[model samples]
Target chain A: MSKALLYDATLCIDCKQCEAACADQNKLPYDDNIAKEERQSEHKFTAVLSKNDKYMRRLCMNCQEPACVSVCPVAALRKTSEGPVIYEANRCMGCRYCMAACPFGVPKYEWSSLNPKVRKCTMCPDRVLAGRQTACAENCPTGATKFGDRDELINEARKRIQDNPANYIHHIYGVEEVGGTSVLLLSGVPFEEFGYRTDFPRDPLPLRTYQVLSKIPDFIPLGFVTLGGIWWITHRREAVAAAEGRQAHQAGKELK
Target chain B: MKIKFTFWKAVFLLIVAAGAYGTFVRFFRGLGASTNLSDQFPWGIWIGFDVLCGVMLAAGGFTLTAAVHILNIQRLKPIVRPTILTAFLGYVLVSVALLFDLGRPYNIWHPLIMRNPHSVMFEVAYCVMLYTTVLALEFSPIVLERFNLQKPLKVVKAVLIPLVLLGVILSTLHQSSLGTLYLIMPTKLHPFWYTPLLPVFFFLSAIAVGLAMTIFESSMSSKHFGRELELPILQELGRVLLVVLTVYAILRFEDLLHRGVFHQLLVAGYERNLFLLEIVLALVLPLTLLAIPKIRQSAGGLYLAAVSVVLGFITNRLNVSITGMETAAGLHYVPKWTEIAITGAIIAVGFALFALAVNYLPIFPEHREAAGPEAPVAAKAAVLSHAGD
Candidate 1:
C-alpha cells in the first residue's frame, strides 16, 4: 500500500492555513535572514500559487522514483521505509545536483543560510509515524489536500472525475507523469495550462537522464583506438629516424 | 620580452583581498547575498563559468595527449604537459566552486563514504575524485623532473602511457557525465537546450573546445613566454579546430531540427538574440576563419578563433544551466555582491595556483624541447645504465 496525498487546487481557497499549520507543526522560522529584497516568494513546503484566475498548491509530488533522491550525490535524501522521499540536511553536501535534477523543479535551497539545506515538503513523515495526520491534510478547511494510501486516493479521485465530467478535467495529474507520482492532483483546467508538467515519458527519471550517458561507452574505445593508431605511426617514424641517424654517425666516425 | 609578473602579483593580491571580503559576506549573509541565483535560477555564473567552461578549457590535456602519446604525434608533445597542468588547475577550480555551492560543505565526505550506487551524482562524485587522482598522477612527472629526481621520474615515465589513456577515458566519461547530470531535470531544462542528444553535444563541443583552448592557451603561452611559437604545430591545430566547429555547427542545427526547436530560434527575443550571437561568434565565425587554409596557418588569426570558440562554449553553458532554465516559482535570483566576490575568489585562486606551478614547476616547455628536444643525455645516463645492468 503506497502512501500518497491528493491535492485538489479547485478546493483550495488560498487561506494559507496549510502553510501556517506546516510552519507551526515543523517549528520553522519566518527566515528573517531572507531580507525583504531577498524574499521574492513565500517560503514553505506547500505553497499556494495564484495567477490568471487560478490557484495551485505547490508541494512535493513524490514521484515513483523521485528525481531528488536519485540525483542526490550523497544519500542525504532518501525514500523512507514507508514511502516518503526525505532529506537529512546533516548529510547533504549541498552540491545542488538534486535541485538541478528534479523534473518538477520542486527542491528549494536554503540560500539564506551560511550552511543551506534543500527544502521541500516531506509529507509530514514524523506525524505519520506517530499515527497522526499531516499538517496540510489535518488543517485544510476545504479538504483540498487529503492523505491516505495511494491506490485508495487514486480510485477516489477517479470516481469523482467520473461523476462530474464538466466539473473536472478527465486526466489525473501525476497518475503517469514522469512514471507516476505518489502525490496526485485533481483540477478543473488542464494540468499543462496551469504550468503542470504532463508531457513526461514513462521511463524512470534516471533512465531519461542516461539519454546522454549511455553513448559514452562507444566513444571511450573509439577515442583511444584512434589515439593508439596515431601513437604507433609516430613512434614507428621516430624509431626509423633514430636508427638512420645512428648509422650515419657510425659511418662518419669510421671515416675520421 | 619576458614581462616579469610582479604586475600579476599585485593584481593577485588585490583580487585575494576582495575575494576574502566577499566570502565573509556570503558566509554571514547566505548564497542569495552572494549570487544572482534563485529557485528559478539555482545555477548561475558560478556553475556556468566555473564548471562548464573550466572543464572544456581543460580538454586540452585529453585532446593533446591523444595526439601525442596516444596517436604518437610527437609534434604535439610541447603542448601536452602544459595543457595537463592547466587542466589540473581547472578541475581544482571546479572542485572549489562545488564546495562553495554546497549547502553543507562539512558533510561532503558523507557521500564519499556512504556509497550510494543508485545515484547519478554518486557516480559523479566518485568520478571527480578518481579523475582528480588520475590528473595528479598524470602531472607528477613535472614535479619530479624539476627536482632532477631521475629515479622517480623514470618510474613515472613508465606509467605515463597507461596513465595518459586512463586520463582520456576518464575525461570522456566525466565530460559527458556532466551533461547527464542534467538528465533528471528534463522539464526544468529548456527544450531548446535540453535534447536527448545533450551528452553527445557536450562530448562533441568538449572535443572542439578542448582543441580550441589548447590552441588558445598554447598561443598565449608562446606570446608571453618568449618560446619560439610552434606555428606549424598550431597550423595543424587550426585545421582540427575547423573540422570540430564544422561538425558542432551541423549537429547543433540538427539537434534543433530534431527537437523542432528551430522555430524557437526565430522567437524574436533575447534568447533568440543570444542564440544568433552564439551561432555567429562561437561557431560560424571560428569555422569560417579556420576553414581558409592560409588564415589557419597564421598564428594570430588561429588564436582568435580559439578564443571565440571558448566564448561560444561559455555562452552555451550559461544558456543551458541558467538563462534558459526556468525553475523555481515567483523566484528569480540575482547574484549577490558576495556571489561575485566568491566567484572572483575561485578565479583568483586558479590564477594564483597557475602562477605558483609555472614558477616552481616546469609547466612551460623550454625552447629547445619543441625543436625536437629530448631529455638531457647526462640526466638519462644513470637511468640508461641502470636499465643495462
Candidate 2:
C-alpha cells in the first residue's frame, strides 16, 4: 500500500516533537529551539511553520507528479512506486533545477559543502517499507500527524471534516492542488493564510510542459524547411543577378 | 611590437588576482563562501551573466555565418571569421564559468552518458555540447590555414557547408531550449517574463541580439584594429535590426495581452520599473534609432543602436534568470564581492584571448580580399600551395 501522511493543524500544539524526531532519524543535528529556526533547511527536513497562532508542517508535499522528478536531467530524483520522492546522490551533478522546479520550494542545496547534494524529505521510505510509520508521524505526541495507506488517509481526513463541520474548513488541502500531493492537510482556517499556494491549476505542472514539447516535432520540420527555403531563394536570386551582370558586361565589350 | 603597461591592464590584473582568490575559495570552501547563492537563490549572476548573457552574446557566430554562407549576402563575408572567433571564445568562457557554477564539476560528463530525454535541461546540455563542437569545426579551417596545412584544410573545407548548416540547426535548437529550461518554473517566474511562448520569444530575441552583436563587434574591431568599416553592410544590419526588434516588441506586447497581464505593467513596483526600463532601452530606443534611414546609415548611429540592443538583451536575460525569481525566493540576493571579481576575470580573460587571436591569426580578411570576389579562395589556395612546399 502507498503510504501517506494527514496533518491536522487543529490538533498540532507546535511542540515540534516531529521536527526533533525527523532530525534524529535523518542523523542531522537537532535544534533545541526550533520555533526560532522555523523554515526547513539542510539539517531540518520538516519544520512546523507557526503563523497567526496556527501551526503547519513545512516539508516536501511529495507531489503525485513532482516537478523535481520531471525536471532532473540525470533522473537523480525519482518518485518511488510505493510512495515518497527519493533522490540518489550518486547520480546528481548538482544542477539544482530541482530546487527551482519544486512548487513548495521544498528542496534545499548543500551550498556550503565542497560536494553539495539536494536535500529534501524522503518521507522515511525505509521506515514506511518496514511497515512502521515515518519518524515524524511516529513521534507525534498530539495525534496531529497520522500515516497509513493514501486512500484510507484521505477518507479519514474527510471523515474528520464531516464530523467537525463547525471546527474544520470543510476542505482538504492537497486533494486537487498540483494534481494532488501524497501529504494531505486539514486546517481550521484557509490554507493561503499559512503561505500555502491555493491558486495552482488542478493538472500536473509537467503536463503543461509536455503539451509545449509535443509541438516540437511539428516545429523542427517547419523551421528547417522554412530556413532552407529562404536560403535557396536568396542564393538563387543572387546567383541569377551575378550571371546577368556578367552577360551584360560581355555584351558591352562586344558592342565596343 | 612592444606592449604597454596601461591602467586597464593593471586593473585587469588586480581583478584576476582577486578572482583567483575567489576561485580558490570556491573550490575549497564551496559555493556558499564564494557566491551569494543559497537554497532560496541557488542561481546568481554567474548563471545570469556568464552562461545566459554569454551564450546570447555569442549568437553572432551562427547568425553571421547563415547570412553570408547561406543567404548569399556576399558583402557580409568580411566579418564572418572574426565573428566566429569571438563566438568560439565566448562559448569556451561560458563552459569555464559553468564548470565553476556546478557543484560537482567532475561529473559534468554525466549529462553526456546519461539519457534523460524528457528533461529540457538534457536537451540544453546536448545542444551546448554539439554546438560547441560545431563551432570548433567551423573555426578549424582558419587554424589549418595559419599552419599552412593544405591536406587537412581540403578535408575540412569539403565538409564546411554541411557543418555550417548543422551549426545553424543546433544554434536554433539550444537558443530556444534555453527558454524551455525555464518552462518548468511557471509559478516561480513572474508572469511578466513567463509566457507559454517563451521559447518563441527567446528565439526571436536571440536573432535580434545576434545581428546587433555582429554590428557591435564589427564596429569595435574597425576602430581598435584599424580595419576599415564595412559601412554598407553595417547599415543593412541596422535596418534588419529594426525589423527584428519590431517583431520582438510586438510579440512581447501580444504575449502580455494574451495573458491579460498588460495591467501588470502599470502596477507601481520595482519589477514594473525594471520591466519598463528593459522595454524602453532594449527595444523601443533602438527600434526608433534604427528606423531612420540617415541614422541607420551613419556609423555612430548604427553603433549606438547595436549597443542598446546588446544591453537590452543582457537586461532581459538577467531579469528572466534573477529578478523574476527574487520575489519567489522571499529574500533578495546580492552577489558577493567574490562573485563580481570572478565574473570580471572571466570576461577580462576572454578579451585577452580575443586580442591574442587577432594579433596572431588572419581573422580579418585583407583589404584586397574585402574588395575582390575571389580573394578568399585565392588566399586559401596560396596557403595550401605553401603547405604543399
Candidate 3:
C-alpha cells in the first residue's frame, strides 16, 4: 500500500505545472519563473532544474531510511510508515544538522526567521493518506509524474526501460541509491547528466554513523576505568608518601 | 567623572559597541540578513572558531585537573585554579556563541527535554551541558573561599576527587563527539579532514593544545600578574606537547595512507596547500621548536611555540568547518562583518571576566608568600609540593 512517484524525465516538457501545483497546495507564492529556481529553497520546496534542453524535478527523494530523519536530534523530521518523509515545525529546535546530513541536500532552513524551521518537499503525505495523488503528480500535464504503489511503479519503470531500450537509460535512478528512495526517476539521458547524485553508496548514510556510535558504550567504561585507575594510583602514592613521612616525623620526636 | 582613555580599553569598548549592534541586528533581522550562512553553507566561523576551537582551548581544565589531582603532578597544582576558570569561561562563551548561531535561538533547550540518542549532536549537547556544570562545580571552591564560606568549602572538598574524574570523563566524550558531528558529512567534508578516526584525532590534538594553552595562560599571567613562571613545569609541558604533536601527526598521515588518499597531498591544489600548512605550522613547527631544550626552557621561546600551536589548531578547525566544504557549498561564504564583530566581543568579554576573577579571587595559589624573592626556584617548588599535599 506504500505509495511512490515515477518521474520520467523524457515526458517532462519543462512546463512547471507541478511546481505551480505544489506552490498552490503548500500555500507558497505562485511563481511563473519556476525554472529559474535551480535549487529548492524554504519557499520553493519543488523546482524544475533544467540542463541542456531537458528538465528534472528537484525535490526530496524521500528515502526509506532517510539521513535527515536519522540525524535530527529531536526527531523533528520523520519518515512515516505510510511512505513520505515529513517535518514537524513545532518539534524542531532548529539545530539544522539535518540540512548537513542529507546527501541530496534536500532540507532548507528558514534562516531569516526569528523562529526558523527546516523546509522540504513532504510529497503530500496528507493527500496520500486520504488515498489521493500528491499535488505535483495530480497536476503533471504530460503524465511525467505518475503516483502509485511503490513496487508497481518500480516494475512499470523497469518495463518501460526494457520495452524502449534504445530510448531510455538502462538504470532506474532511485532503485538502490541510498538504500532505495520512495521516488523513482527515469530519464532518457544518464541520471548523472540530469544532476542526480549517482555517486552515493547503496547503503543508507546512517549506517556509517551507527558503526561509530555503536562503540560509545565501550568508550564510556574504558575511559572511566582507565582514568579512575590513574587517579587512584597517583593519589594513593601521594597519600602513602604523606603517611610514611608522618610516621618518620613521629619517630624523630620519640628519639628527641 | 571621566574614564581613562587607554588604547586597549578604547578598543575593548569599540568591540563591545560593535558587537552589541551586531547582536541586535542578528536577533531582529534574522540569521539570513546578518550572517553569510545559507542552505549550502549552514555552518560558518561561529561554529568553527567559537564552538570548536573554544572547546579545545578550554581543555586545559580537564587536563590540568587530571594531572594535578589524579596523576599527583605537584608542580602543576598552582595553576589548576586559573586553568579551571579559563575553561569555565570558555565553555560559557561557546554556549553563548551557539545561541547566536542557532536559527531558533529560543529552542536551544529542546535537547534537554527531547531525547534523540541516534544523533551525534545529541551526545555533544548532553556532554557540553554536563561538562559545563562539572566545571562550575570544580570552580566553586574558589568562589566559596572568597566569600569565607568554610562549611561549603569543606563540603566541596569532600567531592573534589570525584568531580575531577567526572570532568575528565565528560571532556573526553564531548571533545571527541565534536569530531563525530562531521562523520555523517563524509561527502561534503573534504577527504583531508575526513577520516574514520576523526574523533581520535580531535581528542589527541585537544590534549596537545590543552597543554599548550596552559603554558600560554601561565606565561601571560606571569608577565602581568607578576607571579613566578614555574619554568620547570612549563618546560616539562613543552616536552609533553612535542610528544603529543608527533603522535597526532603520525596518526593523521597514517589515516590518509590507509584511506589511499596519500596522493591527495601530492596534488598541487588549495586543499592540499591548506592541509600542508595546517600540519606543518600547527604540528611540525611547534613540535620541532619544543623538542629543543633551549627553546623549552626560555620563556619567550616557549611563548612563541605555544602561540604557533594555538594559531595552527585554530586554522585546522576553520579548515575543517569552512575550507573543507567550500567546493560542495558552490557559493563562497565570507562571514559578514557582524559575525566577526560578535566573535571579537565574546573573546573580549571572556578576557574581562577572567581578569575580574583573577583580581578578586586567589587564582595564583598563594605564590608571593611561598615563592619569596629570597627563595630559590627549587626551594619554592618544594614549598608548593608540600602545600599541595
Candidate 4:
C-alpha cells in the first residue's frame, strides 16, 4: 500500500519538468540560475543531471529504515508507513547527525540562515495521501517519472526490462540499495555512471548502529556491580586495617 | 586585586577578543558563513577537536577518582581535586563549543525530553549531562571547605564514595559511546581507523590519556605555582602509562591484522602516513621514554613522555574524525580561521578559569600536609569524623 516513485532514465527526454514541478510543490525558489544547477540544495529539492546524452533525476532516496531517523537524538525524522521519510522542523535541534548519517548525502542544511533546518525531499506526502500523483509525476511529459504503489512499480520495472532487455539495464537501482528505498530507478547505463552510489550494503544502515546501542542495557548493570563490589571490598579492607591499628595502640597504652 | 598584563596574558586576551568576534559572526551569520563545513563535510574541528579531544583529555577526572576512591590508592588523593576541576571546566567548555557548532543551538535541551534510545548520540548526551552533574558534586567539597560550609561539606563527604563510583560508570559509558557514534560510518570511515572494536579502542585510549593528562597537568602546575614536582607519583603514572601504551598498541595492530587491513600500513598514502604518525606519537615515543627507569624517574623525562602521549591522543582523534573521511567526502576540509579562533578561545577560557580557581580554591593540599606520610591517615580521619557527624 506504500507509494513509490519509479524513474526511467531512458524515457526521460531532458524535459526538466520534474525539476520545475518539484520546486513549485516544495515552495522553493526556482529561477534560471537555480534551475541550471545540477545539485540538490536547500533551495532546490530535486535536480536533473545530463551526462553522455542521458538524463537522470536526483532526490532523497527515503529509505525504508532511514539512518538519519535512527541517528537523530531528538527523533525529528521518522519513516511514515506510507513510504515517505518525513522531518519535523520544530523537533529538530539542528545537531546535523542526520547530515552525517545519511548514506546518500541527501539532507541539506540551511547553513546560511541564523535559524537553520535540514531540508530534503518529503516525497509529497500530502499528495500521496490524497490519492493524487506527486507534482513531478503529474508534470512529466512522458511516463518517465511514474508514481504508484511500490510493489506495482517494482513489477512494472521488471516488465520493462523483460520486454526490452536490449534497451534497459537488467538491474533495478533501489530494489536492494540501503535495504530497498521507496524511490526506484531504471537506467540504460550503469547507475554509477549517473553518479549514483552502487556500493551500498543491501542491509539497512541503521542496524549497524543498533548492534552497538543494544548492548548498553547489559553493560550498565555489569559496570555498576563491578564498581560497587570494588568500592565495598576496598573500603572494608581500609576499615579493618584502621581497627587493627587502634587495638594495637590500646594494647601498647595498657602495657605502659 | 590587580591583574598583571604579562606577554602571554596579553596574547590570551587578544585570542579571547578574536574569539568573541567569531562567536558573534557564528551566531548572526550562521555556520555556513563562519565555517568550511558543507553537506559533504558536516563536522569540522568543533566536533573533532573541541568536543572529542576535550572530553578525552578530561578522562583524568574519573580515572583518578576511581584509583583513589574505589581502588583505595590513597597516595593519589592530593592530585584528585585539580583533576576534577579540570574535568568540570573541560565539560563546561565542550558544552559552550557545541552551542557554536549546532545549527539550532537554542534547541539543545530537546534531547532531554525527546528520546531516541536507538541513537548513540542520545546516549552520549545523557551521559555527558549526568557525568557533569556528578563531577560538580565530586568537586563541591573543595568549594565547601573554601567557604567553610561545614554542614554541606559533611553531607557531600558522606556521599563521596558513591559519587565517585557513579562518575566512573558514566565516564565509561560516554567515552565508549563516542566511538559508537562513528560505527554507523563504516563505508565512509577509512579502514585503518574503522573496526567493530572501535568502542573498546576508544575506552582504552581514554584511560591511557587520562593517566598521561594527570602527569602533564601536575608537571605544568608544579612549575607555574613554584611548588616541588610530585616526581614519585608522576613516575608511577609513567610506569602505568607504559603498560597501557603497550596493550593499546598490541590491540590496535591486532585489530588491523584481524580485519585484513594490515596491508594498508605498508601503502604509501596520506592515511597510512597519518596512522603511522599517530602510533609513533601515542605509543612508541611514550613507551620508549617510560621504559627506561632512569628516564621514567626524572621529572623532565616523565613530563616529555606524558606530553607525547597527549599529543598522540589528539592526533588519533583528529585522524578518526576528519582525516579518515576525506576521500569519501571528496574534499579536504580545512577549518576556517573563524573556527580555529573559536576553538582557541574555548581553550583559553579553560586556562583562565583554571588559574582563577587555583588562586581562590584549595585545589592542592598544603605543602607540609602533602609532604607527610600521615596525609592519607589524616584524610581518612576527616572522612570518619564527617560520617559520624
Best by lDDT: 4
- The alpha-carbon RMSD values of the candidates against the true structure, listed in the order shown, are 7.4, 5.8, 5.4, 6.0
Question: What TM-score quantifies how close candidate 3 is to the native fold?
Answer: 0.93
What tens-digit string does per-residue lDDT give for candidate 2 at B224-294?
66678899989888888898899898888888988999788778987888888899889988988888888
Query: Comparing candidate 1 with candidate 3, which one achieves the higher TM-score?
Result: 3
| Candidate 1: true interface contacts recovered | 0.77
Candidate 4 residue-wise lDDT, B1-389, digit = tens: 33444556556778888899999899989999999999899999999999999999999999999999899888888899989999999999999999999999899999999999999899999999999999999989887877789999999999988888889989999998888899888778899898889888899999999999999989877766566788888877888888888898899889888899987777799988989899899989889988899999999999899989999989999999999989888899999999999998888778777766775677887642233322222222221221101
- How does residue A111 of candidate 4 score in lDDT? 89
Show where candidate 3 strays beyond 4 Å.
A242-256, B1-3, B367-389
| Model 3 residue pairs with clashes | none
What do the candidate models score in CA lDDT, each in turn?
A: 0.74, 0.84, 0.84, 0.88
Q: Give lDDT tens digits, candidate 1, residues A37-124.
A: 2112326666666667666777787788887787777788887755578888778887787777777767888778787878888878
TM-score of 1: 0.86
In model 1, state the lDDT of residue A3: 82
Over A1-256, each residue of candidate 3 has an lDDT whose tens digit, in order, gives 7788999988999888888898888888875565477779998988887888877887899998888888887778889877899988988877788888888888998887898888889999889888899999999999999999999999999899899988788889888988889889988887777568688789888877778778888987887788889988987888899999999999999999
The candidates, ranked best first by TM-score, are: 4, 3, 2, 1
True contacts kept of each: 0.77, 0.64, 0.68, 0.81
TM-score leader? 4
Docking outcome class, model 3: medium
Between candidates 1 and 2, name the one with more favorable DockQ. 2
